[model samples]
Target: MSNGDGSAVRSYHDRTKHSPASVRASRHALDWANQPLAFKIYETLEPIALPRELPPIDVPALEAIARIESSTANECVPDLPTLTQLLYYSAGITRRITHPGGEIYYRAAACTGALYHIDLYLVCGDLPALAAGVYHFGPQDRALRRLRPGDHRRTLIEATGDEAATAAAPVILVCASTYWRNAWKYQARAYRHCFWDAGTLLANLLAVAAARTVPARVVAGFVDRAVERLLDLDPGREAAIALVPLGHTRDRPGPAPDAPPLGLRTVPLSAHEVDYPAICAAHLASSLETPEQVRAWHGQTPRPVAPAPTGPLTPLTPLLGATAPRDAIDRVILRRGSTREFGRVPIGLAAFATTLERATRGVPADFLDPPGASLNDLYLIVNAVDGLRAGAYVFHRERAALELLQEGDFRRDAGYLGLGQDIPADASADVFLLADLAPVLARYGDRGYRAAALEAGIIGGKLYLAAYAHRLGASGLTFFDDDVTSFFSPHAREKSVLFLVALGMSARRAQVVPSA
Candidate 1:
């Protein structure tokens, strides 16, 4: 596959697909001794202490997740405290667990294997109690370490071809990923996790921004080299995945001063690291080289509308007029964790419908045209839901209904599709997010894969929050890609599974100490 061509991403996806035979044939084993550290540490930089005692936004979790658009008013700039709260609720370390091995720092968002490979950086103009500069978010210490001084939002604006959101934004959050941190466990597939993890983080960011009335939008179209250079990131190791413009401003900053090389030091991830060339190749293949290319990639091609449902379509009972969950976004995120075991108890149909309705409302992203359009379709295997029959169904986001695909218990089938995990088999519902890759790849080239997977991850993240807000449990799981498509064939014959999230009642309470 040619570099910068969409082929590289397509090749990687086809190569990394999970199958029953592939799983059985593989002899991969975890190397506990060589496990990478969950947090990225910068050695020389002094931490810029952020406010730990943040006042929580009062927006209900359900209402927050359902917000589709960001505030457009220019006066809605986020001050230091608001920015601090946004970062904390989005990617900050929320819980600490002590074990014989030592401490495990779990973050605000759900990550694959709890391996927090994704890192956050801040670029902004001066704000109340904060200076204009480039800074890295150290979730371990809950502080920001300045990497460079002076405003640098213009660099991002240029990289994004003067994207409207980035141009008017007072602060921009850059999401990057360190390959080896997650690759230690997932290997080449860790490439996909880069966007998946970022998507999950953005899920929190967008929701929190909405709750706080801060303008925010995910910017995926940007010159790859430009962003990496601005962040001083090694493209081969840590690369920028997405840029999110936070808050709003009528004034645009002047041209950025030349960004010189900064040879900053970072603590080693582990005693040793493994390199996966496939991951790097896939990234390079989908990367946009020029600002013009970035501009062209801004909008997504319109998806073909689905035909009317011929089967029995059950209208969704969304919690629109019903009272929303009282738990605020921060409290919900602090309590959220991947369910280790499901109770197999049936969740009320209203709760299930609320989760689906709220999560799929849509995301404000660059790849999605018209802002709120989604790139993936949602399919579900209903194991147990009060008032819902045990069967398979595809969600109609537009119509707000479920089109019955098959009527039968798919407990075993769900388990098999989820790489033989009991989580899906035992959960109340397993949402399989699938996309037709052909059109996606054709439209955005190889990068569309990232957009599709990222969209699924964002929605999956929302599902996690919605489930937890209602005092239920939710976990994101991997699946046998082809099998998932096969299980939902006819309706999803051409689509490929991008992400899976299982939701249900928890079997036991998780033990986690709140972060100080």
Candidate 2:
């Protein structure tokens, strides 16, 4: 709830942590009849239907994004077709499956509940093939609906205190979460989901932008009220979470139009939605009130180190080189979907090794441990990895091999750890990321929550990329907090699980191909 006001909030370590009984106790057994939806619909503005025609892009362009090769902001500008391709590949529904229950649609990224709540809004200057305007990306239809017809990039620049990326971007992408979409299943935890879910989606968006040779950067600090008004969203329900400045333009943007409120209407997503108090409370706490406040939160000093590695250190040896003849990130994304059914089989140790090597090769971020260091530790329950013994092990970044802690099949344990999800139990291995949080919270305060979640997502995103590269399957998973810490305890005693990813062979091929 604390958006980022330098509040000395207690980390998850300091909380009067919930016991199994306490977790259930804190869980408000919602009365289904009384469930309240999360989005606050304004009865005025008409629903603007999006365009249905989205052209296809080449795989090489997509690969450029995943590899961050498209990050150079020079003279390149995104045309209308490129914009459409980015949005469609980032969050559009790629596959629809008919089940006994009904039809279930899968999106571009793997979200916790598959509760697609995050929305994309575009602000830009006039460009070739498209008029200059503020627009909303409709994932369902793979199109853009014009909201305000003019350049509004200057408003964002002012909101971000003229952050270099925001100031120079030709078009900016805004991500907002409608609380109810996820809260329907997760309730209060939806607040955390807002970032986690959004982060995963951004992972795809960022990579896609890179593929298009469009330079983009994530901006988390901005004047909250100013952005909320510019998009005319109800901060209580649908609030902006992050921004991405897409491509570059030589011409400086002029002043933004006075953001007069336009109350928009939309169809209800579900029958009902339940509100979570803790989530909303946490969101409010971190919100920035002014541009000055946002400016103050921009930079962070490098973390001080204590000691060097003492454990067996092994450097990663990925199967494919950075320039391997792999499918482009765009092609991989169009084909990616979370594995709902994993086959119980031993994944080649080399395959597992390659994934770790490629995914952990550091992401571009200012808040990381250092240039090559990461804040979290990768621990695993090796249910099955060919040529590797079944065991509990810690991945030493310096040493690419598993430092075995204990050996045995913990398939059932893995199932329980994943909050009873069958995916982890059946997967060859489940990679659990744990971090020492005392220093993290002390350094960044409540904002550390954002860092931990974001870092986990970037790596998880890389895992998705790496797994696909290896002809394997992977899915981001959720778990019982304490149970996970306890599973990797003694060694992981002081550490906490930040994120989980299950990797193995999938039982069925459900990859989607976007309509041309």
Candidate 3:
């Protein structure tokens, strides 16, 4: 891959893409004997146990999924219990399936292939029940292991260009990805999955924070090396992807002490690791090097091109209060799972409309200026729905309507675009998020690639919750990137594929969280 240029970014994207010929010609098989460890375990640290007695979030799942920011007016800081809830629901283990070989631990969010590659770390000042420190959240035991023992938020404040949220935040959450853990299955494309999996987890994180009335905002722009250094991460194996500043504070941290290396030890993920140079090169190309560069990188959100309605337009009628489901956020997340096999059943148009409406409302991130602006446009292949025609369509977010792009059944094409996956063909509807990367890369630079994929995953995560609320099923699927754009073109000629999500009825019921 080329170095330090936009073409290098495109090189990684194009090389990792799935196509008909590439899928058939490749001989990449799973190495079951050397599968990576599920958890990133520290061998020499003591675990500070978190509270097992958790509080219930009573906010309705639908209500919280649509909300972008907290409604609280006065300043509030999360206590030990509130902090516990945030970590537990977002990534903590909620259920275990006992197999003959051993057990499979399922987390709060659905990850690609159940690998659980994403990890969360908390950096905060002195709180009511906790001391100032940098800590790693261990889901295996529902406890935190301190990595450094002093206030390090000042370092983060500077890393994020002293952004308003990070400066005022009392607690911040940093999400990072260990390449080998996910790359064991995905190989080079694991770089993309890094943001996709984190986006899904952020969905859970943001929703739980909102239900608890804690102000949480996602910061994607930062001095990458600065954050990696604060978290004591090795750029080779693990690197920071996103940050969430939780709660507001008038108080600010003074200068942080010099971070001498802790040199902590951890269990090995596998006996041998395969190095993918493209992943590192792509990350380096996108990474911001200094505060000055970080400040200049962000600007106005890219406006999408919404052509005039070329066909029939059906305005979305999402269910409102008193008519929508009242299930709490906890219940929805606990029941959520990636649908293994989608049944060819027709769901109500209202249910489909509601999911799209709530999930695309907005993402609370720095890249999306003015709150509700989005980088991607939604194009869909509707196969089964009660009130809507079975055809190709594009969703107009501002107008809240689905404009028919073409009137026909494309079940075969749906499966093809999804890389010959049955889930897309058999599902009620398939949504492909396409982005005009020229503007995204031009505006946000190579890092914009990360932002576009991240935003798609966040919205994709919300779609998961929204679908579950209506008793429907949802799954994130891989695609043949160029093929998708071609299928949705003339209109999408300049656009590129970012993500795909399928929604339908489930073939079998998903496992639920066992009661205590």
TM-score of each: 0.97, 0.86, 0.97
| lDDT tens per residue, model 2, 58-141 | 554224433543545367788877877778777788888999976777788878767678888999888877678888876655
State each candidate's clash count.
0, 22, 0
Q: What is the lDDT of residue 245 in candidate 1?
A: 93
Better of 2 and 3 by TM-score: 3
lDDT of 3 by residue, 346-365 (tens): 88888888999999999989
Deviation of model 1 at 260, angstroms: 1.4
Residue 465 error, candidate 3, Å? 0.6
Candidate 3, poorest ten consecutive residues by summed lDDT: 507-516
Alpha-carbon deviation at 78 in model 3, angstroms = 0.7
Q: Which portions of model 2 miss their true places by more than 4 Å?
A: 1-19, 22-66, 69-73, 98-102, 270-273, 301-315, 322-325, 365-374, 398-402, 508-516
Model 1, 1-516: lDDT tens digits are 222446778789989999988888888899998888888898999999999899968888899988987658557679988988888988998878899978878789999999999999999998888889999999888899998889899999989999999999999999999999999999999998998889889999989999998888888889888889888998779889899998888888987878898988888888998899999888888888888888888875558788789778889887764565678888999999999898767888888999999999889888888756888999999998888889999999999899899999999999899999999998989999998888888888888888898888999999999999988899999999888998998899989888999998887632231111
Ranking by lDDT: 3, 1, 2
